[model samples]
Target: MDIRRYAPLRAAGASWKDIAAQAGCDWRTAKKYLSPDAPAVPPRATSRAGTVSRLVDPFTDVIDAWLADDPGLLATVIHERLVADYGFTGHYQRIKVYCAEARRRIELESDAQGRPPGLHRRFEVVAGAQAQVDWGDEGCLLVGAGAGKKVYSFHMTLSYSRDPFICFTTSQDLATFFDCHRRAFAHFGGVPATIVYDRTKTVVRRHVAPGRAVPLHPQAAAFAEHYGFAIDVLAAHRPTGKGRVERQVQIGRDHVLSGRRFSSLAELDAAFAAWVPIRRGQVHRTHGEVIAVRAVRDHAALGPLPQFGYAVTETHLRRVGRDALISFAGSSYSVAARAADGRVTKAGQRVEVRVGVEHLEIWRLPVDSPDRTPMLLARHPLAAVRGQMIVDPQHWAELPDGHTRSTTLDITDHAPVAAQQVPGDPTPSSVSGSMVFGESQAALEVMVARRPLAYYDRLAGLAAPPEPATTAETTTSESLVGAA
Candidate 1:
């Protein structure tokens, strides 16, 4: 309160009560301030310094040990450990406050590796000299009918221009990984000199001992060779080696997908496509130039793409099942029983399967052929959902089934026998080499002709029975037929 304002009022014959009422202060304070020589004294401000709760003091050493072991340990986790193991009777906020200071101390002391946290070389690559790549796990998305599928994003950011390219996929297999690389290169209009990647299995065949030569994935090597770029595989636990793309991964999630819901991979990709231009127009923090403008210089310095596009397909050897099906990508695809060259693909025969992002090709292995060339067996569009069976009806044509019985009869062996007749009956005439046994039907049927009892007696190798006398009409017809 300023006492000078009430001083004039006090000198004008105002009582202490009246001055206190006017000044909104107590009457005793008004009497002191209203005095002629009373000096204005601002209220002394007081503050209580914040300190770690005394309740947590007992557990400070344990907390420090945990923090030193892992500087990134969360406060809630520490609080839980303290409550469960240390019998700490403190609120979570106290533990949180303590952890903040503890973490700062740990960070200042240096990381667990005994290196200062801030001691690192900041790098800036020349235009088109290098690009970084990484994958972001976007969790599950309801694609169709609320069926959830794991979604992932492929990110590539030019180290110089900060130009970013992102695409969404349902898979992170070797084929899909390079397929996204091809797309990113195309979007940037050329390939960089070196592409930096963390030791993803797609990029690195296996983890090798430190200082040993890293073995690059065969397909990755081929892809990089085809695109005229070098594969720079970062060491384990070295995310900062490709920090440009690592940061872009988060930027993509925050700017494009933070508040959006997508029904399909296409929609998610479209969201990225729409945001990329907006990102390019903004001034980059490090480069201090519009990303699109800097991207032009980067694109101009990049190496030209190869004349032919590299086929990004993951090749695997699969044995054809007895059912002429080959299992792949959690689904089964049918291969033709009879190959194009008229060779039958029997069970247990290994075939080469080249799986692409959207389709898969089955090739018959040339195991014992004069020309060692694989024959294309079948091509099928990939299944939309897992556990699906993709079948071609024609592929099962040569395979036997229960419904393949024939309806025709062959009687050429029995054609030479002459027709026999009984007494007083016209003899049946034989035709051609085959006989019409019965009416056309699914099952073959034969009609048996009746013969005299004497013929059966002769065929039994017994004494021939005496022949009975024939009627005159039968005798005349028989004689006329014999004469003709």
Candidate 2:
């Protein structure tokens, strides 16, 4: 103790004997205390008996059981459950400390006895042989009214070259799904022999047990047949089967969409299109070749496009309304009252509607004679907004107007016009030689028919005369005409 206190003074040039005299110890004793070989530090036993207990010590078994059940169980959760169930009145810190150590011990033990994770071998295919497809959720990229709408990216990556194509859409419907495929094919200028896909409902009709044949959607099969390619559906829950496109989904989001605000799907797609050139210029880590250069070889090996484009149209049956309108996708589209061949289209008749990406066609097929050709009723651009009514003014041309198909009798059709005329009546030539009496009569009739009868009837009440038998039918026809 004396040497320890006087060490600083001695090192500061103080004499040892003088330091001892100041320390109230003999100079010889001080010298022995300062000896180099003397034991300056005390030694203790290497082991100790258990003297203290932890609050978690009693609950150690319970803690271990919980950790065995769920390795990732939170310490706070354990503490809460322990306090409620076990009557353990301990601070959360004690439980947290114990759980951490217990989890670590359990993890080590589990790792020592656990089986190794499954591993997959890296795969490669020849140029143009294979492509992988996947969809990514971009999560509400649009602004304003569409801000809540989720944006999705459809990705196709050539397995050999790692060349990627992406297009943004708001829907994952079958039409949008295949439309994206068409766009991808056009981007590559040819089609790969096989396209890998997850079991999306658009591609797979229904899921089946493993080791069984997977059923493909009918339109999907037809599309593949037309394009001369095969659909390779990945095994259930195996995203790694199409890892190329799966990885590309994240890559596209990071490289092109990250930190950017897109108000529309087209803007998002354009951003990806602009970044594609840069991506192709860089060397891919797996392939070790510039994507653009490798893509050239891939494109060259691809099969030629078919002579005719596959019709990416979805067909549905819709009944023509009395107004010559059909409802589809929450919008109303006009169909001509008469087909192109002059065959009349009646209300409540079921017509086939072929819906395309940007347009739709209404066809009146011959139900009575299947061999007879289907008549095209109308072709119209799809409505931009839902609940909109897309009308073609010409579709209503054949409705019962005064000049054509009028309920009013045509005097010439029933009898000779000259014989029907009375002798006292003014001659048609006396009125005006250049004027057409038939046209005048039709115009007068149309004007009188437009006058509303409801107001007059409401005013007259019980005094109103008995209505004509055809009044109800006439009213319905007029309403339909007004709607058209």
Candidate 3:
């Protein structure tokens, strides 16, 4: 406290209490200052230094080693290790109590020397300057999809507006991650200057030494390069570094996903899309600005999307199935029979399958050199329906000669099946084929059509099995169908 005001009061005969109140000091201190006998001594501030507690203190070194080995290790685990290895027969409770206190202190002391403990200061970036991306697991939400199948939601939050672009996928593989990036850019209508991310596996390949640049995954690098954005990987264990997106993940889980039941990943994505406008209309919890209002700045600040959008692809070398088909992303896509004959003779015929977000492309080994790019075999729209066998019409070109492009045949005879069913015919059938090994066979015939069960059901007004047609009913039905 400054003693000048109280000094004048002391000289003016005011009481020390009143003087100290005016000076904002203790009465005793005012008396001392009034005593000119006390040398002008500055107040002594308390020191944080203290004697270390020994309850867990004796085992601090052991705990330190354990923590150094694994900072995430629990106190209980450390205590057990201490007793088993160090032969310190201390009570488990004592060790546990010490551990609860020690781990935090030890970790902070170890990795963060000279780093002061304090609340994280929230930061704001200029609009279009930054976006934060993260992934969260929304566990086991689909029925008949698979057991223990988890859906992960990828979120990219515009740092300025809190505008979020979200995607849900079954995997965080390279292709899906890159695809999400592309979709996020499209959703924002522009690309941010930079994207901040936690050191997720999809982006970061491994943890390098501290203070050194982290090596990004190749696909992640390609994606960023394609989009003209910089990647800013957050420091290890520092979610607060990109707290905007981190908080959004929690908010999204609670607001959008909590207590909701979805039958598929697509349903989950649709739900997020429907929920986003509500979030945009609401005030951002952290910045206290309406998300939609802030988004205008964000949109203005972003760089225009590149001329050609990113084509994110994940390539896999898969053995062609015996049926000249390659299975990918829950669907089977066919290869040409001639291509399969040339390339897929054995059970393990390897073909490169490059899977995109909404397209599937097939590639075969380079004709001459392994170093050369694989030959592009076929491209097809990704199937939205599960278990669909997607076939490019051209992929079945190597059928026996004289067969039309659309002809489908079941070869049950040793000789060729010459009969081709009329495309729209129904039930003129009395045909069958049989194959005998090393024996001559008769000319074969095949019949294919939509079953007449539904027509007959309507005609009879009951779910009756298809019976042999009666002459009168068949004629009347055909005439009525043709006239209608």
- Cα lDDT of model 1 by residue, 354-416, tens digit: 999888999977773448887899999999887999999899987777796756555543333
Query: Whole-model lDDT for model 1 versus the true structure?
Result: 0.82
Pitting candidate 1 against candidate 2, the one with the higher TM-score is 1
Candidate with the larger TM-score of 2 and 3: 3
Model 1 lDDT at residue 160: 91
Sorting all predicted structures by TM-score, with the top scorer first, yields: 1, 3, 2
Clashes counted in candidate 1 amount to 0
Instruction: Write the number of the candidate with greater lDDT, choosing between 1 and 2.
Output: 1
Candidate 3 clashes between residue pairs 3 or more apart in a chain or in different chains:
none
Model 1, residue pairs in steric clash: none
Candidate 3, residue 115: Cα displacement in angstroms equals 1.6
Measured by lDDT, the strongest candidate is 1
* Model 1 ranges with Cα > 4 A deviation: 1-118, 142-147, 405-484
**Superposition TM-score, candidate 3 onto the true structure:** 0.62
Q: Which residue pairs clash in candidate 2?
A: none
